[model samples]
Every structure is written in structure tokens, then in C-alpha cells.
Target chain A: MAKALLLNPTAFEAGLVAAARARALSPAQSAALEAFSKTGLPHRRIEAWKWTDIRANLRDDLSSASAANDVIAPSIFGGLGAFEITIMNGAAEWSGEAPAGVTISCTPQGGPLSELASNHPLANLAFLNTDETIAINVAEGASVEKPLLIRRIAGGGAIHQRVTVKVGACSKVTIIESFDGVGRYFSNSVTEFSIESGASVERLVLQNGSDDGVETALCAVAAETMSKFHQTALLLGARIVRIESRIALGGEDAQADLRSASMLCGMRHADVTSQIDHRAKGCTTRQLHKSALKDKADGVFQGKFLVARGAQKTDARMSVNALLLSDFAEARHKPELEIYADDVECAHGSTVGALDDAALFYIKSRGLDDAAARALLTEAFLGEAFDAMPHPAIERTFRTRIARWLEAGK
Target chain B: MLKIEDLHVAVGGHEILKGLSLEVPAGEVHAVMGPNGSGKSTLSFTLAGREDYEVTAGDVTLEGENLLQLAANERAAKGVFLSFQNPMEIPGVATMNFIRTALNAQRKTRGEEEVSAADFLKLIREKGKLVGLSDEKLKRPFNVGFSGGEKKRMEMLQLALFQPRFVIMDETDSGLDIDALKMVGEVVNSLRAPDRGFLVITHYQRLLDYIKPDRVHILAAGRIVKSGGPELAAELEKSGYDQFIKAA
Candidate 1:
């Protein structure tokens, strides 16, 4: 077996290979496992995983336990009147009336891996371990009145899951994917979104994890002509977490808006990374990321926009700003732009610094105490990304989460 | 309503206010005229309870309460307002919302009832118009993209809204036009009452033309060198601060 042939592997890697060998693997799963075995697990040595070293995090052998039967709490989005689908550990379950014009199904295994999934090591790991892939399909020319919520809950084990969303032409849908968990566990998830021509998808990912949890979620998106993909992610770090996205604007005149905020405190860490590929003409992309770190926490953001040779008139701009609240807190950012088209406009910027003392003193002099002033300033710094949320309730929900983090810090 | 006794302030271990004593009785407007680096701003900041300005010695009291024992926000709650010389441009902080929050926070700290949102909106719009700021400008972030005159006008707007007991205008007229200076005088004159006091710090007498002062003091070399009537401002403006600098 490849497990024995592989050179000195870590305990976690060996445990993963042993678990795969014990199961009746499908052909696709075996292919993914073989591909994953070549690189073992992403670590500091890998250029992409330099800031987030997964191998170093999972040094000990972790058993592949079944999903814990913990009592599931109501999701924070329960008031949105949306259709809910729950994924506990690696298992998927849903019992409710699906949203109008939306059909859901499950397959024993997903189809061949996409270009992005094939290259990402964490995505391959998830694909190999997940037995059922939940697929949500929106009908053509349908405007769904309700949102679709995917609640992922994990507990006590190494769990992996896969989900795919397909939006038909001229349809509109909002999807909220939330990650919540308890106790010690490792969660690796891969999600794919295929938006047809003229379709619109608003994706919101909220992750709040336990202190002992390690999670990696990678989402790949393929946007067609005139399609719109707007995504916002709020990542509250766990022991170690990385949420990444790979977007390909393959059709002309497509647009994408990606914004993310990470508020990490204590000893936790979070990394938000994305790579947007502009392969069509006249496509526009705007990306912004903000992070506020406190205590001894660490935050990282890595973003790149690539405009292809034929992607003329592509307009893309990316900005990242981090506010460090402590002397020991750290923020690392890398924003890059690679353009081969002469007519394209692409730019990127990054900044990392502490909160403005003048602003804080101004606020304090206006009547807010020290803690209240700090909280107000920090919220304003991170609240800019969520200013454009179409739904006021959702925006308030995100702001409430930020407030809770600030409160906890105080 | 405000009194300072032998106040000594140091910034970065360098004394700026050396035994500077002053007093502003209730319903009176006092002007402190000084050249650059003459401890004018240091006095305002020290009285406002700024952390960095070390008070090596002295006492400051507002309404017979020991103001030096409180924090900046607490001092604010105690009705001490220092209109900053250079207002900060705080991005992402809505101007109206922040002013309302500050008003409510001060009220709450003083064990008073908070204002309703509707009432706050109405009050801000009224004051914003008085300060020559449109509703669009008030909707933007606090002082963001605002001109120097507009920022000072916003400060006047706050002054009108808060109506604190003690007011310290630290170089409030440095960047204002004649019209804005008139607006500042109007706001201060309108807020004047039997229990309120004003300390207007300025370099020129132009702003004094609109809001006449009961007394004017020339500050130089970290101390008050001379005192006179409002005519002192006109006199110093004509002769400049050269004589006072030499005398110090």
C-alpha cells in the first residue's frame, strides 16, 4: 500500500491512510487518496501553506471517530425563514420543505475533481473521506424568495465533508454556510459553486469554532457570462483555521465581490486566502479583507488576482488592512496582481498597524470609556466590509458577532 | 465655574505649563492669547485629563469638584468639553451616530436619561444646518473628507448639542473663515448661561470681534504674562507677540 511506501509520515498522516485502507474505497476516492498521498499534508515548507502549517498543528495520531450525537442548537440564521440543511461531522441530514424552485439530492460520491479541487491538498483530503456529497440545484430563471442555510456542526474527531451548489441560468439564490463545533476535532471541507449565465449567488460563510478545533474549508467557484458571485466570510479563529476560495471568471462581463473579516483573540489563529482568475473579457472584481487581532493571536490574508492574456478590460482591485490590538499580536498579509492583458486595470494594497491613538482619544474624550472606545474603534475598522450586506438582519447578525468578540476581549 | 491653581504640566518629561494659574467665573468668557509653543494647548489638554500630559503639580476644579481625579470620559461627563485644535478624521464612524452616542454616553454616565433616536436625528439636523453642514455631510464618517472649516463647524455642532457646563476652545478659530467664526460665536453665545463658563484660546482678535471676552490674558513661556480687557486682543494683534516673548 502507498501508506507503507511513503517515507516517514506523521502520526496524523498515517492515521488518515490507515482509515482509508480500512474502508471500501470508490475508484474516485482512491484516486483522490493517491493524489493526497503524494504531498501528505500541507506544512510550513509549502509556499501556499507557509503561514498556516496544518501538519504542525496535527502532530499526534488522531482517531477517525464517528459523528458525536450532541444535541444540535438552533442556528443563528433560524430567524431568516430559510430552508436549513444540517451536516454533523461527515454526515448530512435535512428534513424540511425545500425552498421554491430548488431541488436537493445526494450522491454516494461526487463526479471527477475540478481543476481547483485537484490542486488543493485539503480539498482532496475532504473528497477522499466524504461518502455523501450534498448537491443543491436551483431551477432556471427562478428567483427564490428564501435563503438556503447549511449548518455544519462537528465534535471530537477528524471529519471531512463535501457540498456542491448549482445555480441555473437567470436564477438568484442566497446561501449561508455556518460552521460551529465543540471539543477537539479536525474538519476539512470542500464546497463548489457552478453559476450559469446571468445567475446570481450570494454566499455567506460564518465560522465559530472551539478552542481545540482545527478546520480548513476551501470553496471553488465557476462563474459564467453575466453571472454575479458575491461572497462575505466572517472567520472567528479556532486553534488553527484557514478558509480559502478559488474563483474563475470564465465568461465575459461576469462580476465578483469578495469581502472577509477575521476577528481573532487569545492564542487562536486564522488565515483567509483567495485566488481569483480572470479568464474572460470585461470582467470586474473587487476584494477587501480586514482583520483585528488581540492578545497573542495571529491573523493572515493572502490574495492574488490574475488577468489572462485575452481577458482585456478586466478591472480588479484588492485591499487588505489589519489592526493589531496588542504588542504580541501579529498580522501578515500578501496581496498580489499578475496581469498579462495590456488593457486591464489591476491593483492591490496591504497595510498592518495598531489602532489610531488619536482616534481612540478623540472617542474617549467624547464620552466612551477606554474599553468602550476601543470596542467602537475596532468594530468600525472591521465593520466596513459588512456595510454592503443586502439584508439588514444578516448585517446586524454579523455585527453582533463582532460585538461579542469585542466584548470577550474586554 | 473653572479654576486652576499653580498647574504644572509636562509632556515627554519637558515642562510646558509652569505654575500657570487662571480662573473663569460662571457666565464669563476668558480669552488666552499666546504665540506658538506657549503652553496654550498643553493647558487645555491637561484640564481635559489627557493621559500623556503629566501633571507634576497643581489642582484643577470644575464646579468645586476635583477634575484632576477623573479620566477623560469621566471629566467629559462632569461637563468639561475641550474642542480639539485639530479634529480627527475617524473613518467608518458615522458622524451623526457617533455624536449621538457620545451625547447619550455622557448623559448616561451622569445618571441622566438618554435621548431618543428620533429626537437625536432632529437635533443633529437642526444643529448641522446651523453649522452649515448638509445632511449628506452628517451622514458620512466622522470628519472624513471634511474641510478644515467644516471640521470646526462640526465641533461647533457638538458644542451646541452637548451644552456642557465648562467649554475650552483650543485654537478653534485657527482654520475657520469669517462666517465660521461668526457661527462659533453664535453657538457659544447661545449656550451661555448663569452656570456655564467659556475659555476661548486664540492667537488673533478676529474671532473675538463676534464673541466679546470679559478678560484676555497673554500667555508666554508657560505662564500668563499679562491680563487686560478685550482690547488686549486688538492690541496684541497689532503689535504681535514679540514684546511678550521678550518679557517672558
Candidate 2:
């Protein structure tokens, strides 16, 4: 019994092993399962997940069965008129026509895990359990007029999904992925994006989970020469949620922009972490994160930029700020830069504090009650991160989400 | 219209207003002249219902309503406005939207109908021009990157917009030029009403030259040392608060 417990420390892990044994697994899936066995689940003991202890939060046997099929809410971004792809309960489904110069397909077997996911436990778990892999490809030198919407909705139990997007050379496409779920469940997903030379991809994510759900999404991006990748995410935390991104600028003159905001209340938690690797010269990256926490909610942000020895003249800056509305609310931020090249310009800043007393008084003196004043200030604080989004309708949708959160807080 | 009886206020455990008492009747503007550290701004903040200004012993009433029992915003709904000596630079808050929200909030609390957006835009544009603020300046974030005079202009603009029952101007003329001072006087003169009252707290007599006050009081050592007609302002301006400080 002791040896068996050591092999599978958690009931969730035991369920995963049982499910894998019931099916014929590919070598990659077998390797991923083997890697996941080394560490049952990331906890406080791990340096990378000190503030977000996943093992401590999960208790039940999450791998028992998939979530119950329910009517999914319409996408908040339905007005964008994008080609819609819905993935529910680890199953991929779509019926719309693909956009011009774009091809969408799904395969029963997922591809091998990339280097970023090779060592990530959660990403490995998602890869090993995914039922199908969805692929979106845009042809070279093609500009897709409409956007691409990937709506991932989940409910109950455990669910894992995977998606890969490839933008051909000089192509442009906008992708919006929204994560929504209901009831108690564990939703783990892994998404990969490959941007070729001179290609551009704008990705927007909106994650709002149920009060009892646990979600973890890992995105890996590889950008070639002159490629551009921009991503913005708004996360309203759940029981426990983590959104992590790893981007590698592999060619000269590549650029990436990452921005995210999280507003959490009650006992919910949210973590937004990113690691950007500058491997080539003249690459630029900018990242900003904002969070507003109230009650006993927790917010975490960990960002690191690594400039290699050959990646001279690299430019990168990161700013992380959090506002604690209640005395019990907590925020933890870790920003670091490791540069082997002396000519690179990289900097990061973090600040965590309550609302300004004078500003609150000023707003109140103008006739807003305490709650209204706080909500207004909090909205303004988080609104700055969404100002640079290119799509007006998409921007309004994010703003509307923020307003709803504020209303609930009030 | 406003009355403070034996008000004793403390800040950070130190008494700032010691047994101070004063009154300003309706349909009149009263000027309170004082040197630095004379509790003029403390009185303004206490009247505006700032949380930091603790009223250890006092009775403040506006139109016979107990102002001490209400919060800052409640007092605002009751028509209490303070033009901050140093107007805050609140970034990311649009100027017009914020003012409109405040206006609607006040109107809602008073059981009055809210002003529509188009009507508010027109009103603000008309009043913004009255306070020498252009349409372009009114479109920017609240007080962001504004010059000192422009911030004062914003204060005046709000003063004109709210048109509160009781107004407290704390050093509203400290950083203004001649033209801006004239603008301030014009806005105040336009808002003066028979049922409304004003308390202009200042260090100099230049602001009084524009909007003539009905009475002037000398504040020293957290109490009113002298009270007289508007001529008292000119007298104190020349003689200064040295004698009054010594008497206290």
C-alpha cells in the first residue's frame, strides 16, 4: 500500500492511471503520463507554484468522469461575427465554414508536446488526457477579414483539451478564446501558436469560472523573424485558476505584447504567469498585469524575461499592479529579468496597495457613495490595460465584463 | 444657513480646532482670513465630512439638519461642496463622465430626476466655457497633466456645476493669475443666490476684491479672533495676522 501510494499520491492521479490503462495510448501520451507521475500535483513546496498550491486545493477524485452536458451560454463576443469553434467537455465540435485562406481540422490523436510543455506538469496532464486535438491553419500571405472564436465551456468532473494554431508567413488573424464553466470541475488545457515570418496574431482571452471549478490553461508561442504576437486576457477567478504563457522569440525583430487583468472576490483565486525567452537580436516584448482583490480572494503574478547571450539589443518591460480593497485580500507578485547580453534593455516594476484615500474622498465629495466610489476607482484602475486593444467591439465586451464584476462587488 | 457651535476637532490625536464657533447666514458670502496653521483648512475639511477630521466635541447643522450624522457623500447630496486647495489629479477618470456621474448620483439621492446625457453634455459645455475651460480640455482625464491654474479652473467648473447650498473655498486663489482670479470671481458671482451661502477661506485679500464678501473674520490659534464687516478684510490684509496670533 505504501508503494502504491507513492506511485499515485492522489485519488485524481489514480483515476488518471486507470483511465489511461483502459485505452490504447500513443508513445507521447505514455511519456506525458510518466512525467506527470513524478509529481502528483504542484504544491506550495514547489518554487514556481508557491503562491498557487494546486495539490492542496484539489480533494475529490476529479478523474471519475467527464462533466455533464448542459446548455452553454452564448459567447459574449458573438457580435464579432467570427467563425466559431466550441470545445465542451474535452470534445471538439464545430459546424461553421472556415474563413478564407483558413483551414480547421481535428484529429483523434494529439501531436507531441513541445519543449515548453515537456517539463510542465499540468500541460503534460492535459496532453495525456485530451480526446482530440483541434488545428487552425491560415495560408501564407493571406489576411483573414473575420476573427476566429474558440469557446471552451466545461461542467463537472475532469476535462482536458488541446488546440494548435499556425499562422503562415505574412498572414494575419485575430483569435478570441473564452473560458466558461459551471459547477465543480477541473478543466486543464494546452494551446500552442506558431507564427511564421512577418505573420501577426492577436489573441484575446476571457476566463470566468464557477465558484467550485478549478482551471489551468498553458499557452506556448513560438515567433519567427519579424513575427508579431499580441495577447490580452481578463480573468475572474474561481476556486483556483491559473493561466500561464511561455513565448520564445526565435528570430530577429520579433515582437510580443502580453496584457492581463484579474478581479477576484470572496475565496476565489487567480494566477497569471509568463516566461518570455528572447533568443534572437532586436526582439521587443511588453507586458502589463493588473488585479483588484476583495474579501479573502488571492491574486498572483509571476513574470520573467530571459535575454540570451546572442540576443543583443533586446527591449522588454513589465509592470504589475494590484489593488487590495479589503484588509484580508492578498496579492503576491514576482517579476524578474535574467540577461546574459549586456546591451539589452529590460526592466520590471510591481506595486500593491489600497485605494488612495484622497482620491476616494474627492470622488465621494462629488456625491458617490462609498461602494460606488470604490467601484468607479477600481474600474478606472483596471481600464488602462484594455485601452490598446484594436477591436472596439471586443474592447467594449471586456469593459462590460469589468462593469459586471464591479456591480457584483458592490 | 450654516452654523458651528463650540466645535472641537482633532487630527492624528492632536487638537486642530479648539472650541471654534462661527456662523454664516443665508444670502451672504463670508471670508475667513488667517495665517498658516490657523485651522482654516481643517474647518473646511471637517465641514466637508472628511473622515480624518474627528469632531471631538461639536454641533454642525446645515439648514437645521445634523450634518455630523451623515457621511461625506450624504452631506454632498445635502448641497455641501468644497473646492480643494490642491485639486487631485485623478488619472484614467474622464472629466465629463465623472462629473455627470456625480451629478446624477446627487440628483438620485435627492429624489430628483437625472439629467440626460445630451442635456448634461450641453450644460457642461456651456458651463465649461463660463469657467474658461474649452471643449478640448473638458474631454481629457480629470485634472491629468493640468497646469495649476487649470486645476483651479476645474474646481471652479465643478463649483458652477454642482451649485451646492454651502460652498467652502480653501485657498482657491493661492495659485491663480489675474485672469484666472477674475474667472473665479465671475463664476462665484454668477452662482450667488439668496438661499445659498459661501465661506471663502484665503490668505490674501486679492480674491475678495472680485467677489465682495458681506463679512470677514480673522482666524488664529484655531478660533475666530475678530469679526467685522467686509472692510475688515482690507484691514487684516495690510496689518496681517501677527496681532491676532499674539492676542490668541
Candidate 3:
């Protein structure tokens, strides 16, 4: 049993606790749920959760919701010939072969979630909720040509999924994680990534949410010696969507590149928060994030780069730019750097403003109407975020989505 | 032909062009020479229908079409082109793509078929060479990382590509080298036709040396105070705008 709760739990938390009690939860999972109930949902008073009051935004008590058969939609990246794995509403399924050097399966159970990741609130909720973990492994020294896609789908209810991926030494692989939901729902997902020495891994996320749907996608990635990790994401937010990337460079000469972009419309809300820890010598990290918001959409970016003691020659830089397209749109950014090592070079920057009127007029004078001019400038503003992305088809798809969003906004 | 009658424009609650009037007939190139604060840029912007430059009272007709009643882009579609004094550097917009898109937009608005990509590529290459711009420059982002002269060259490139009916060169000669200035002269001279007209706004007679204007008008304060033949440019270059400023 957990100690005396310092705060009163909400009805949602009570319902979740009751649901956990009714299920055959492992001791570790029961403990995780008890801890979660103690904290309930993150509130505005909490420093990290101040800007994003998940508890206040989540109005429904998502304890009892149907987790039965969900209608899965075809993936947007289907034509890319990717190895597809579908996790619909808490159940996992896959079609076709796994291809050479790649393995996919579902585990019977999981012991404990990542200890380092659980230090934050709402961290490992997926692990406590899901009965089994879907695993994907790339064999050693094998370069998988086709992309491995994990498409997670949710309906108008609470759904959770846990995924574990590992890229063996000297192997190269691309993994794309897509989150999509329908109607009002709470979709929670957690993915753990491991990249061994001399291996390279790329993870791309495309999160498209339905109206009034709430989603949270948390990723914990660890890079070993000489391992390279790249993560890119494009998010069109929903009612309230929070995407968190927690990357740790654990061995010497590791490299990590994390980038994301968000384009929100209507009254949608989105948050992209990341934490990168350079825990070893000669590690490098580069991060760039941008958000173009319209209507009454609210966007938030919180990034932090930590250089541990004795982590010399650690080179890291992060920048965030937010464009508020409408008067009612809001963007909040917090970029932090904590370096205990004197020999490290680290920098962070953030900018928020509207579209450049001069640029808009320049294009308009060239014969583009106001809408077309604005859309062109906005798309140009977002050009660099996707330059490093692999696969032209996926890149084109993301650009098409942005163009559609821009058209709808006008 | 471009016609303006008693054009009164205000920017940011302050009147800039107060009952100013001028005219450039078809097949003629007229230069509007004025010192700073004489509303040279305002005149061009107002004619092109920029939103910020509010026209409190005015009648600007381009070939008998009511330009004052149109939007900026609509005016462009009507073959009204104003080359800005200071062009903006739009990063991330590929130069070729933007030009092609703008050209297609205007064509679409006019209910014309869009030019094929291959045709556009050849056309842009030809214009790009005429403006002394390279293929590498065409591959870059629009005006991004370009010098002042290069930006003017870009303006000339569009001027050639669009082939507007009425052209307003707002200080297109300001930041150009000898070769670039000569290129501008060549481009304008090449595009000169009987059915088209030009309004060349500048503070110097050096550019006029390259492309001789049929008429020169001295704008003081907000209105043209003096109008004469080509010799007026050389005369004003020697006498300065002090005489016109005092008279207005």
C-alpha cells in the first residue's frame, strides 16, 4: 500500500484505481497504479505541469471505457512498403512477413517500467495499463531497407500501448510511430528504444488526432558508444496532446538528434517537451522544434539539455521557433541548459512571433493572393525542420498535410 | 497607360500623398524625381494598392481600369507591377518554385492555362540570364542570402517573367553596380512596347542616363510641382529638389 496521500484523488483517479483492482495486475503494476493514484493527474500548481493542466483539461472519468475490437484505419505511410504493426485500442496485431533481420512479437507480461523515466509524472502510465508489450528487434549488423511502422489507433475511449524496440550493434533501421484517434478519447503510449554501439536508428512520429481527443506519447531512448539516434515528429494537435522525448546519451562519442514540429488549428492544444542528458564524454546533441498555430490553438515547448559532471567535449544546441498565425493563438516556450562540466559547449534559443508582413507582401506583389502568400511563407518557415528526414515519400506526406492545414485555416 | 487624379493617401493616420496627380501615357517612360519624404514610395505603393497606404481620396486608373478598387494581388493580375525599393528575403521558399507559383497564380486568376514546368524552367532560365542571375541563384531560396544588387536583379527577373502592362520601378537603381544598372537599362529597354507604360521613381539621374525617360516630373511634398521633357532630369540633378520643395 502507498503511504498517506498528501492530496485528494479525483473521481477519475478513484475510478482508475478501482479498475486496476478489478484486473489481474502484477505486483509491480499494482504498485505503479497506487503511485499514480496518489499523484492523480498533473495539475496547474505543479511547476512542470503549470502550463499544461492535464487534470483540468481531462474532464471525463476515463476509468471504464470499451477496450474491445477497434476499427483500424489504413496508414498514411502504407505505400512506402513499410513493415506494419498495428496496436488498436490496447490490442496488438501485425500482418505479412517481418522481413529479413527484423523480428516482431508480443510479450506475455512486463516487470517494471523504466526507473529513470518514472521520475516524472504521467511517465509510465502505459506500462501500468497495458497487459503486454509489443517488441521489435533488428538483428546485429543488418541494415533493414524498408521502414518499420507501428500504427496505434484509438476510439472514443481510454487506450494504452507499450512498445519496446532495439537496434543491435552495427545495424541501421528506421522506425515510424504513428498515433491516431477518433472522437473524444485518452490515448496513452510509451516506447522504449535501445541503440547499441556503431548502430544507427531513426524514429519518426506522425501524430494526427481527432477532434476533442487527448493523447500522450512518451519515448525513452538510450544511445550507447558510437551509436546515432535521430527522432523527428510532425504533430497536428487535438483537444490536448502532449509528446515527450526523453533521450540519454550513455556512452562515449554518442550522437543524438531530436527534432519536432507542430501545426495546430481550431481550439486544439499541443505540447512538445524534451529532455536530453549528456551523461558521457564527447557526446553531441542537436535539437530544433517549431510550432505554427492558428485559430485559438495553444502550443507549448519545454526543452532541457543537461551536461553531467566530467562529461567533457559535450556539444549540444537547441532552438525553438513558434509562429502565432491568429490573434487568439498562444505559444509558451521554456528552454533550459544545466552544464556542470566547464569544457562543454551548449546553447539554447527560442523565438515567437507572427508571419513576416514584408515577406507576405513581397510574395503578394509577385501575384500570389493573400492566402497563398501566407501559406507559402509559413511553409518556407517550416522548411528546415524536415531537411534531415529520410524517405522522400514520408516527407512529402507531411508537407501535404501542412498544406492542407494551411488551406483549411484560410 | 496609367492615370492618377488627385490621389490623396494617408499612412498611419498621417497624410503622405495629398492630392498628388500624374500621368504616364502609353509608349512613354516617365520619371518621378523627389527627395526624401516627398512620397515617391507612397505613390508607387498606393498605385499598387498596398493595404497600409490608405487612399483617403483618389482615382487611379490603369488603362481605364479602376486600380483603386482592387486588392494588391488583383492589381498585379491586372498587369500592375511595383518593384519594391527594399525587397524582402523569404527564406525556405525555393526561388524557382516561388516564381513559378506566382506566375501560375496570376494566370489562374486570369482564367488562363498554367505554363508547363518545362516551359517555365526555360522561361526562367532566359530571364535569369537577362538579369545576370545564374542557375545556382535560381535554385536558392527566394532572395535569401542574396546581396542588395542580387535582390534588384531578382526584381528584374520577375519583371521580365510577368511582363506587366504598367511598371513602377521604385528606386530599382538605388543599390546597383555599373553592370547591374546597365542590365536594368537593357531589361527595361528590351521590354519597351507601344501598348505598355513605365513609371520610374528615383532620386538620381544616373539611371536615367542608361534608359532616357520621355518625360520627367518633379514631385515635392506630396504632388508633382513641375513636369518637363528629358532635360528636366539633368536640370534637377544640378539644381537639386530645394527649388521644388520651396515651391510646393
| Most accurate candidate by DockQ | 2
Could you tell which candidate, 1 or 2, scores higher by DockQ?
Answer: 2
Candidate 1 docking: what grade? Answer: high
lDDT to native, each model: 0.90, 0.90, 0.86
Task: For residues B1-248, write the lDDT of model 2, one tens digit per residue.
Answer: 89999999999999989988889999899999999999999999999989988999989999999999999999999999999999988887899999999999999999999999999999999989898999999999899999999999999999998889999999999889999999999999989999999999999999999989999999899989899998899898788889999999
Ranked by lDDT, top first: 2, 1, 3
Tell how far residue A259 is off in model 2, in angstroms: 0.9
Candidate 2: residue pairs that collide:
none
**DockQ, all models:** 0.82, 0.85, 0.84
Error of 3 at A332 (Å): 0.3
| Candidate 3 per-residue C-alpha lDDT over B1-248 given as tens digits, one digit per residue, 9 for 90 to 100 | 78899999999999999898888999899999999999999999888877888999979998888898888888888898888899988888889998999999889889999999999999999999999999999999889999999999999999999999999999999989999999999999999999899999999999999989999999888999999999999998898999889999
Q: What's model 3's lDDT at A303?
A: 94
Error of 3 at A298 (Å): 0.2
lDDT of 3 at A208: 87
lDDT of 1 by residue, A83-187 (tens): 889888878888977988999988877786677777898888888887888988999998997889999998768989999989999999999999987777898
